[model samples]
Target: MLPQHADPIVAIATAPGRGAVGIVRVSGKGLAPFVRALIGREPRPREATYGPWRAADGQAIDHGLSLWFPAPHSYTGEDVLELQGHGGPVVLQLLLARCLEVAQTALPGLRLARAGEFTERAFLNDKLDLAQAEAVADLIDASTEAAARSAARSLAGAFSQRVHALRDALIHLRMLVEATLDFPEEEIDFLQKADAEGQLQRLRSALAQLQAEARQGALLRDGLQVVIAGQPNAGKSSLLNALAGAELAIVTPIAGTTRDVVQQTIQIEGVPLHVTDTAGLRDSPEVDEVERIGIERAWQRIHGADAVLFLHDLTRWREPRYRVGDANILRGLPEGVPVLHVWNKVDQAGDELPRGDSDIVLSAKHGTGLDALRQRLLQLAGWQSGSEGLFMARERHLRALARVGEHLEQAQGLLTRAADQLDLLAEELRLAQHALGEITGEFTADDLLGVIFSRFCIGK
Candidate 1:
């Protein structure tokens, strides 16, 4: 059971404001007393009881349906009470307030729910594992259907079980290897004769596959941040409006119309794209205080983007000019992250939409070449067009996986070393196992858990 010895927490589970129904949820030991105080005795488990939730003076606050979930079987592994009533903002607030007052009177130490304390309690009590707890938040905040489904799969332990399976395999190998270490006299010959290297290779292959899948999931969760950069009036802002399907940035024939950076999030075939449009890259006397700040922010965005769409106007695709700016900005963008050499206003340029085989032609105003641009983005993200099997993941998972990769590299080095340091190899293997365990919360710290769940909304 959870720490129901502490006070119960009360919160409105449903969305705030007017609607057909609003639910006020209470969890902990005080649930029964609060329920008894409101509607006489608590109702049957999971059964809807029709009644008027009364105040301390026995006056009806609202006529509603209530359900009681007895201890240990409830969501938080404690007694839970849910009062469903008409969804009026004022009515819901009054209902919540009444429950708090009644709980404080009838049961000592009851208090209002914290931001994500209920879910944290559930996780702490083993009502749900860490992966499932994260899924609760992901499901609530999912902006796309694919994201929601991925989160559901995770909630069902689809992702955790996979990590556990890998951990299990590693444990088996560790047993075999660790046993050899116990008898150092026989280890040299036994390890040399055994297929230890082959086994390590296989483990690495499996880890690589899992790492790839986890990365895909992380992309689905965090999405791609794409920044548009180039000279003045290169259709950078136009591309933003076209992709977002709204006038997110003001476009004009004038060069410096966009003095500040503009951002919009839009889905392209279920892959969320965070597109940013910045002031045209130019030096001008009129570039004032705000515009200068905006330009600095734009540079920051360019530095931290998943992909940079360098909009080189087809009519003016010349050698890299702008002497004051860094030449490496266009020349040495990170290796894997793509920089599309976009030739804009193709219609005006006719059949000659800039030369060279490596350029993409598009007209942001006419909506001519957006599909190809989006496809390029998907490609850079390692996503195949019209592909399936995308999952949802977070940066924490990626960091853990990266640690696994690092350990693998170390293990490989130890294996190939002239001295054949089996101890170092074993230590690397152990490190890799520990890193993998972090993804499923087997080795997570309390503060880390606090940070993760605190990002979630209440009543999750």
Candidate 2:
């Protein structure tokens, strides 16, 4: 029998606040007694029964539908109970209180679940692997339709299957190498005859492809952070509004109109880009205390940004002062962050649409060249559009895959260096398999699991 937690857990599974209906879930081993005490009888497994949810004193709490899923066939591989009732917060609380009250005697030690405990139990019970369990949270937290679809695919085992396939191949290759090491006396070149080198080559190729897909998925999970910075009246706020397609920021011709950072998350071809518009960068004794604070905040955002869109006024580019100001701002930019030099307000510059290899020219006010800018932002994000096989992935997953790749590279190097170094090659292959196993929780640390599951909302 599978190991199971003895204590029962209860929680309001639905989102907080009033809605048409709400669900209260209970999970544990042998919850039939608790169900009987609350509803006054046993519920047929897998069947929803309409009844009055009663208190210990037989007082009716609320009439609703109740579902019972027996152990080994339910989520968490435990006896599960679900109460669907009116979504009034008060009503749900009363029902939840009743369940806890009944559990005090009928199912002692029943308590509220910790964040992600439900899914964590599912993982422990073999209902889902580590990646699939994570996908549950990703699906719930998906910010876009594309993200949601990809998360669904992950929850359905798309990503896990790929990892498993790679792991199986690694295991096969490791077995062959280990066997060769065991038979050092039979120096008949069994590896070459078994095509071990060919197998290693194919595994490397597969890992590279999987790594690319995982990178794209990680980008989807953690969207790009783009900060827009420029001098006052450089159309920074205007570009923010243009990108967001909403008047989210107060756009004014007056310099330093945006004295605080304004943020908007806009989607380009289904990839989310978090854009921040910051206060103008100009030093003057007339700059007020609040504007100075905003300028400081702008620099902070730029330093943390994945990409920076440094807006330059095309109309003022010819001015000596403007050129000097641009150079100073450029000097202050953080090293290693990709920055796009954007020239805005071509209309005011009285110039035809200009294009260059290193800069993008656009009139943010008229929406000219906006599409090109959007496409450029996507490109900088390393996004691959229209990849139907993409699935949601976390940074941890990427790190695991990267480690696997490194181990594989080391193994390949050892194999190519000398055929007699089979022992070293076997060890590297074993390390690679172990690294790949971490992705699916075949091998993982308890502390890492704690960190991963702690971020989930309570009740999963």
What number of clashing residue pairs does each candidate have, in the order they appear? 1, 0
Question: lDDT tens string, model 2, 211-299?
Answer: 99998888877789999999999999999999988999998878889999999998887788999999999988879999999999999
- Candidate 1 Cα outliers beyond 4 Å, as residue runs: 1-6, 183-195, 286-290, 318-337, 350-356, 412-422
Cα TM-score of candidate 2 = 0.97
Off by over 4 Å in 2: 1-5, 352-355
Q: Give per-residue CA lDDT, model 1, range 134-185, as digits (tens).
A: 8888878887777787888888887887788878877766665676777767
Clashes of 1: 1
RMSD to the true structure for each prediction, in A, is 3.2, 1.7
lDDT of each: 0.78, 0.88
